[model samples]
Target: MMTSDNERARLLPSAALDVLGNDLLLRCASYLDADGLVQLGRTSARFGIPQAGQERSLANEAARQRFRQSATEDERSRLPKYDGESDVGLPVSLTEGIDLEADWERNINPMFVTSSYKSAVAEQLRSQRTAKWGESNVHCCTYGCKDGRCDWTDWDNETGSFDWQGQEELEVSGTIGLLLDLDEGTLSVFKNGLCLGAMKEGLGGEYCWFVNVGSLCTIGISRGRAPN
Candidate 1:
């Protein structure tokens, strides 16, 4: 058979990718996280346009992937998914509603949850309990410490890294809020939806949410937007 010039042209990289199309790219994206998907979109036109709707689709997929991992199958199925059609912020596990109660481990103090990735240090957690929280891959925000004021700190044991020291003299009498903006790499604290301000900036890598519950028997955590 004679080699066709048209066939050779069609077999070129771009043409081959175009033939595979967005569906193929999306299938490849399923293996990737949101960040990977965004990067893929930037690669070529065949991967799909980086438009709002397409971005939302990628985000919805990512949110579902991020959500309810530490939860039981029954709990995950029952968990509400964030409807970006109604919500203003990006769809996330928090926005989709996470049962933090189910995500906790009871200890001497009260309870502490595992990392977002659910990789907890069993021995350390067993020893220190909630005492040396910042020693692990955990992010900490204290409301009332020994100094009788709020403090912010986080750490990564693997890399020996830590930063974010924001002290606020909050009068503990109302609902407290903590928000982690992974995109901008900032953490903000609030009081009853009132934005206190960005406590930390330029945060990097993965971090788990944590708190040192001394005398408090009950801790309530809910997710939504804090007015900017």
Candidate 2:
């Protein structure tokens, strides 16, 4: 039986792989890491677009796993209602695209581009959908650090300096802010209506706002101005 199996394996050619459909291919991709998913998506356009399947895009599915083990079709259809310039605390479930003003401004504060100066940042948002995801996934926290681990700590070593002060932590259910400056190419974070300074920069491309959050976390985003 072993010899027969080996002989059959030798007879099967790489050409047979061409018969494999996107569904099977993507189903197999469920085991890949973020970087691996990104690579697989680039291999073909089908790997990136959403379709009638268990997991739409490989990259999106992998990111969604951080929220739920398996996402239903209803959950994917329910997206944040981005009605220009509103204070809506949208419940987030996946690391997905948020169609904002691309870059909106606020008259209330010169530091922020949103009316929701009170907001929490997450997932180290990239200006591009195909942004390189690494181990430097940024996390936010207002409280609950018992041991040496704090929630508001920045994990990215290349994010310049770790200037996150003790007072920078927000209160329970407090607002956290994130402003993506397209002109200056910087992403600034705010805690309870105060600026935490630019946490990231070098973003000269179009951005799709995304959040990487845990269970039962509600984040709100508000804009005061129109598109640029």
Candidate 3:
């Protein structure tokens, strides 16, 4: 019974390996690391190791196991469950000194003035066919951070500075605002109150807007008809 180690040992001799075919070479390579397999392949032009089958090697499997174990430990040490911009725990007041809890509730504020503000905001959003997410002017949030490197709190906490993969480069002229069209399901960006055309189109379902700004910049969410 030839053990895996013995099979690997048999593959070391360049002269002896010339007689063996590709199938035998792959079987021997299974007990070798990626680099070791490549080295074995170079010994014989006939011993062509398929790139896709490299992971099938036992040594490479061991390497994968070690990497997964380390990644799991790091993932467990995260600070907060990042859902979106709303998860930043920032404070926002709908009116002057009026406290508003961040949660899902329709017609939340019963006060006449607050209700009027909501109505006016919704009306304005409908009239312009544009809506801004969140009630506050400043937002600190990121889109994707699943790799564990782009933690929002890990960077500057105030500005919500974090790395994110975006579809396009947003030309930032000044404090930019993201405006969404509820009817057409399109999204556009406004720089210093100037419309910069539509950024995204065919947006559906409930979507959260996130902004990653520099140290000195500010991100604000204008009041508009809240998506339901």
The most accurate candidate by TM-score is: 1
Query: Candidate 2, residue 41: CA error in Å?
Result: 29
Point out the worst 10-residue segment of candidate 1 by lDDT: 83-92
Please give, for residues 1-228, the per-residue lDDT of candidate 2 as tens digits. Answer: 256877778667444656887556647776775556667667655556665754346545544453345445554344322323111112233435433344332212223222123223213333322433323344222222122122332322322223433325444566556676656866666666666566564555433454433335445565321222
Q: lDDT per residue, candidate 1, 1-228, as tens digits?
A: 877998788678676565665455545565765455556545655343345555544333443444434445644543444333311122233344444556454333544543333345444444554532223343544445323354443322332222335444444545667777666777777766677666666655444565555455555656555676
Residue pairs with colliding backbones in model 2 are 119-176, 119-177, 120-176
* lDDT-best of 1 and 2: 1
What residue runs in model 1 are displaced by over 4 Å at the alpha carbon?
1-167
lDDT of each: 0.49, 0.45, 0.40
Superposed Cα RMSD, model 1? 14.4
lDDT of 3 by residue, 1-228 (tens): 656987778767765756876466546655654455445445543443224445333333332333343334433232222342221111111212222234323124333222133556434433532234323322222332122122222111233433333333344434455665656766555445556455554454334554444344333345432222
Worst lDDT window (10 residues) for model 2?
140-149
In angstroms, give how far residue 141 of model 2 lies from its true place: 16
